[model samples]
Target: MDFYLTALLQGLCFAGIAFGIYISMKIFNIPDITTDGSYTLGGVVSGAMLTHNLSGYLILPAVLLAGALAGALTGIIHTKLKINALLAGILVMTALYSVNLTILGRSNLPLLNMPNLFTLITFTTNINQNSLIILTGFVLVFTLLIGYLLKTDFGIAMRATGNSEPMIRALGVNTDRMKITGLALANALTALSGYLIVQLQGFADISMGIGIVIVGLGSVIIAETIINWLRITSVWWSLVLVMAGAVIFQFVLAFTLNIGIDANLLKLVTAVFVLLIVGLPRLTGRQA
Candidate 1:
């Protein structure tokens, strides 16, 4: 029960990153690996701010701006400089390592003694439940806002930019701006996930975010499967399913760990899980 609860809390925390990746990868078809760096950047920034007695609310905007700037850099490189999108993201991810380390002044920092958002909520002394409620509230608000945005003209244009870039460009849309805006929004959400996660786990390690993109990718893949099965077209329903997918993926990970897998092998397992997630759909289509 404890393991499952932890998984639930972790999943709720991850809901933001899942949404971020959904927008960047699924919506824009851009594999922005800057997620790996921007995630840790958030943790580093939030951890630093909290250690200095900054209000929890104040740290939120700081992390968002940091993540957005990191993402915007990748976007400008890819769009303005005509660099390969993958290369651009990789470059930023690599650079953010030094940036994060500089901000953190070390490889990692602990937040256990610091005042955080979780401690502010007095509803429940039980840490897990309180964290769950806070994360859920944040996720719900973001989901609604993003879902509503997707129904707007700009949102439709963004999707069109993803679905048919050339056609959208011919339609008098500035595809570069759309891509940059989407990446910025996506990274902002990713940073938010990192910010909350550092608080929840009580520490921010430079390595904490390594390969996290796979986790988000797995969640998105799972969400896509469910979306296809249900033929869910409404933006709201899609957001709900994607968030659910993040929870499901975490549950699966917890189950795997509970079955006695070595802790060091978690990344390997995550990779295999992503492979299966990415491969299974094709296998099914081929069988059909």
Candidate 2:
């Protein structure tokens, strides 16, 4: 039971990253590779701050701000320099690799002795219970907050910009600004997920985010396929379905591990899972 609970918590953390990817890829129609770096940046900043005795609450906002800035920089390069969006993302991701290493001043940062949000959960007792409750609360709050944001006027503009940038411009909406805002929000959430992972795992390695984008993309694709089968066309429902899919993916991995799978084989498993999900549409002759 305890192991299952822990796995669920970890899944929720991954779900946040998946949600961020969904926003960038689906909502904004942008292949923002900044997630690869922003995720590590979040871990580096949060872990370094915690090592310096910073409050966990303060670190949370700092991580989010760092991610948003990284994303906005990518957007600026794409919009102002007229670079391809994919190329802009690659540029920002490459720059952030160096920036993250500089931030940590090392190849990795360990948070074993630092105070984190999990430690502050109850402030008094029952550490495991408190941590679980606090994490669950965060997941619910973030999910609802994202749903609400997508229903707002600015959110509608963002959707419009993604669907047709020229049409949005014709409607007097600043498409560039919408693109920047959407990317910022997407990376902010990704960084927040990184912060949570560091808190939960007690360490942040520079290479931890190497293939994170693929993982998030896989979750999004799998979720969309399953949700489409259920006829869930609403954006909010789609988000919920994605979250569920992430949790299920983690559970499947955990099950595989429990069955004596080699630890080093997990990445291979992830890659295979992604390939299967990506090819599902062709296999089924259905549009995804």
Candidate 3:
């Protein structure tokens, strides 16, 4: 029961990345690779701040700000410089590698002793109970906030921009700004997930973000696949699918780990799962 609960909490943590992926892939129609680096960038910044005795409360917003800045820069390069969106994201991701290294001042930062949001919650009594409460709260608040944002006027504009850039531009919506805002918000969510993950796992390694974008993409793909089964077309339904997908993914991973599988094979398993999700539609003779 404890193990299952722990896996559930971890799944909720990864759901934030799924949300980020949805914003980029579905909302903005942008193939963003910056999430891979920006996630670590968030963790590095927050972990470094915490190591310096900074308040954990401040770390959350700080990580979000850092991610947003990184994403905005990517948007600027794409919009102002007329670079391709895919290339722009890659360039920013590449730059973030160095930036993250500088922030951490080395390869990794350990938060084993430093106070974090999780520690504060568990300070009084049962660690497991506090962890569950905090994780649940984080997931609920984030999902609700994202759901609300997607219903706002600006969110509608963003959806319009993604669905049809020319139409949005014709409507005087400032497509470039919408793209920037969407990317910033998306990456901020990704960074927040990373911040939470490091706190949960006890350390933040520089290489921890490797393949993060793929994992996020896989989560989104799996969510869409499942949502398709329900014939659900609403944006809120999509967000729910994202959460469900993350939980399912984590469950599969836990199952594999529990079966005494080699730890090094986890990445291979992730890759295979992604491939299967991506190929499911083709196998079923349906559009993906």
C-alpha-based local distance difference test score of model 3: 0.86
Model 3 Cα lDDT, one tens digit per residue, 93-139: 99999999988998977789988888876634877678778987888
Indicate the worst ten consecutive residues by lDDT in candidate 1: 279-288
Model 3: pairs clashing at backbone N, Cα or C within 3 Å: none
Ranked by TM-score, the better of candidates 2 and 3 is 3
Return the lDDT, model 1, position 8.
90
TM-score for all predictions? 0.95, 0.92, 0.93
Question: How many clashes does each candidate structure show, in the order listed?
Answer: 0, 0, 0
lDDT of each: 0.90, 0.84, 0.86
Number of the top candidate by lDDT?
Answer: 1
Task: Write the residue-wise lDDT of candidate 1 on 114-189 in tens digits.
Answer: 8898998857888888887888898899899999999999999999999999999999999999999999999999
- Model 3: weakest 10-residue lDDT segment is 120-129
Best by TM-score: 1
Quote the lDDT for 101 in model 1: 95
